[model samples]
Target: IPFGFYLFLKTENYIVGWIATLLTGLMVLYAVYTKSLAAWVSISVEAIVFISILIYLVKTGKYQFKIKSRLYALVLTFTGFLLLINIDSGGFNLKFGGLSDQVTSVQEFVQSKSSSGVDVVRSDAAVKGQSSIEWRWSVWLNSMAMIKDNPLIGVGAGNYKIEYPLYNHKVVRDTKFNLESQLDRAHNDYIQAAAEFGITGFVIALWAVVCFYYILFCLFKSDLSDLPGKKLLLAAALMSAGTGMLFNAGFSFPFQRAIPPFIVMLIFAIACVMHAQKIKTSHTSIIDTRLLYAVTFVFTLLFFYIGHYHYTMIKADKYFGRTIRCYNNGNWPQLLNEADKALSYNAGRKRVLFYKGFASNELGKIKESIQYYEELIQYFPNYINGLLNLGIAYGKVGENAKAVETFKKIIVLMPDEGGYYSDAGHYLTKLGKLDQAYTYLKKGAELEKENAIILLNFGVLCMQMKKYSEARKVLKKVAELEPDWDQPKQYLKYIKEQT
Candidate 1:
């Protein structure tokens, strides 16, 4: 896209540049219509470059249209653009026909939230409902604080997601903020790199950026004495691609994507080539043809190796998808097999860790299941299913104490839910900790008011403690909650006899 702009410069055809600018302006309007600030920002770079070219041409007297004519053209063009944006039948239909309402929205929101904006953002985050803007700010601030503490080698590459759940540094926060998912990216490449790579790698990255712009700077200021305007425009166009991506990367994860960062490097490489071309030295070829071919062959092999690596990774995702289908269908053996296939390609896959453990448990490999469930819990401490199933697995293997411990962790993570409390109490009964079991079961029954399963468990615990009257009351409630259940009715009859 930028190369097209460079072509106009090469031919000294400013008319084509003007045409491209006009077309791009329509895109900008559409971006506005769709409320795409990012689209507006990226395409605006071309408009800026064209404007620069226009300024350069006019100053050099190459654009000889009278000033009055230029002003009239600008007014008429802008008017038509507005009409296109606000047409009643097929246009944006924006209120008042322009971006005035957007500006007003900002002003009104700021005025309304001037004193409590931080609280508002924090309250939103408390329930996992933070807007993207607020969410990014929290993650970025927490990540930066983490980086500041570990200023040397970072949290280790690709460890940010794993680290985020345990790290609770806050810039403006609520104590109740509970992140259900670890942020996969900081959403800002610069901050993400700092948190992932630390100062050591960060400085190296900063150096590369400096070197890129330095080359661009040299190209721009180099005495192009008698050199064609083509070089200036070309340099500006190439640099525009890099700058536009740089701007996008500031607020988004362009580096995490496949293409945008590639474009940045491509432009940087082109700029380097341009800078090299300006050298005045008459240098001869430094390498023979045979060595050049050797380099080419080696690079070709490297590319193939990289391609193969990505292919295997993609194959892993394919198997993971199949594994998910099998798991959902309760096909334990197939799920286990597919999970192994995914693990073979990428051993560190987090979800696969739990899926393999779950399938192994379902297939009656209790001992093996314990190990994998333990591994999964270690990987994600706040994982509800992992903790819940791990506790159950521990109980199956007669590790009552371990089961109780795992359920205690779940209770901490989910204090409002009564199921974990009931689970903990059940294990405590097996451990003969009757008093602790009574405490947990009572809490579970209170929290899970209408949960027949919880009430039944609580009633059984009461009977075990020889409190027949309390057992009778709980059993009656369980019978009410589940009228067709034979267990509660049978328990109620037994309690009747005992009473």
Candidate 2:
């Protein structure tokens, strides 16, 4: 697509940025996953090149307007209406859309979660009227922190989740801020690359983008003028192709789809056809058997590898997701077994680590649980589950100071995550940091006042602080929120009797 984009740069800005980006996005969606730096660099460069071309075209008055006939306009209008309906239709809420069948199990999990009182608002909810954006943002921030600590070699590809907790432990140890289960990749491409492949991979990825832009523009200026509409064909193909990739890349994983292969095939086909035409026009040799054979061999190999790779990833992703289901269902043994199976195929998988860590915790192997959680935090620090669990494990081990520090790290990684704040407060209260405990609990309560656990934690803090009136109010709320919880009910009763 990048190569194609440069080819269209000389013809029109409309052909370059907007159109090329859309094409690039579509290709990316077909074959690759964008959770890495390579994909980002590719998209960013194509977008930048297109925008530059657009500006130049606008400045030079070289932009050609394409007028639509009435029939064409009507077709476009109908297509637009159909697309709008598709976008707004609640036919399927799955991200995979038509591919939803392949992920029926995931859809089931989503359905169950929706029924479990979890709002999609988690996507944009404030932890406690604080910036939930910032909370999500912390994943990026902490990921960078991890890269800086181990810049040259990286903690290891897929090691951020494992290393993050150590950094968190070093910085703030009060709350659980595990990264193992909460992330599949670094939310940002640049950060993920630096963490996984170090500075070298980051630089190479950027360089590839630079090369793409140069090639795209060169192709655009190549003279096919004497051949009439030949130039337009080339321009449309490249522009349309690049645009698809860039647009799809903006929000979803385009790289993991078959998009890349199709885009590449389009480019290769254009190059071959154009070269053959140029040779024929020049009265060159009738046939080039060597080049033909090479192209055939290349296509065969590329398709073969692509097919195999796609299937492998599909299988791995499914089993990985199933491991999560096992954990959620409290099938500890199954979780452990499935995690091992997943790791055997794709070792150090962050999601698999979550199952391993949680299952270990459930099985009373605190040391083993901590081991997996710690490893996950180091490699995938952006994830929060491991950190949360690690803090809980520390609490279980009676390492109050370590527990407090862990929770504090969670605050840094996701300050608005009310649950982290609540957990931190609970541990801080245990550590006799009464003032800090009060501050955190109060803040957490404000975020999710309807939360029975948060209110109960606050009531416990108030009781310890000798603020009996505040304690009474908080415990009353706790009782209302969880009438079945004997702890809140008993505490409230004792307070009333004393009064």
State which candidate has the highest TM-score. Answer: 1
lDDT of 2: 0.62
RMSD of each: 6.2, 11.7
Residue pairs with clashing backbones, model 1:
none
Which candidate should be chosen as best, given lDDT against the real structure? 1
Off by over 4 Å in 1: 1-92, 95-129, 168-180, 281-297, 300-304, 327-333, 345-350, 360-368, 375-389, 395-398, 404-499
lDDT of 1 at 457: 94
- List the candidates' TM-scores in order: 0.70, 0.53
For residues 400-461, could you state the per-residue lDDT of candidate 1 as single tens digits? 99999998977765566688899999999999999999999999999988999999999999
lDDT of 2 at 78: 41
Q: Model 2 clash tally?
A: 86
Q: For model 1, give the RMSD to the true fold.
A: 6.2
lDDT of each: 0.74, 0.62
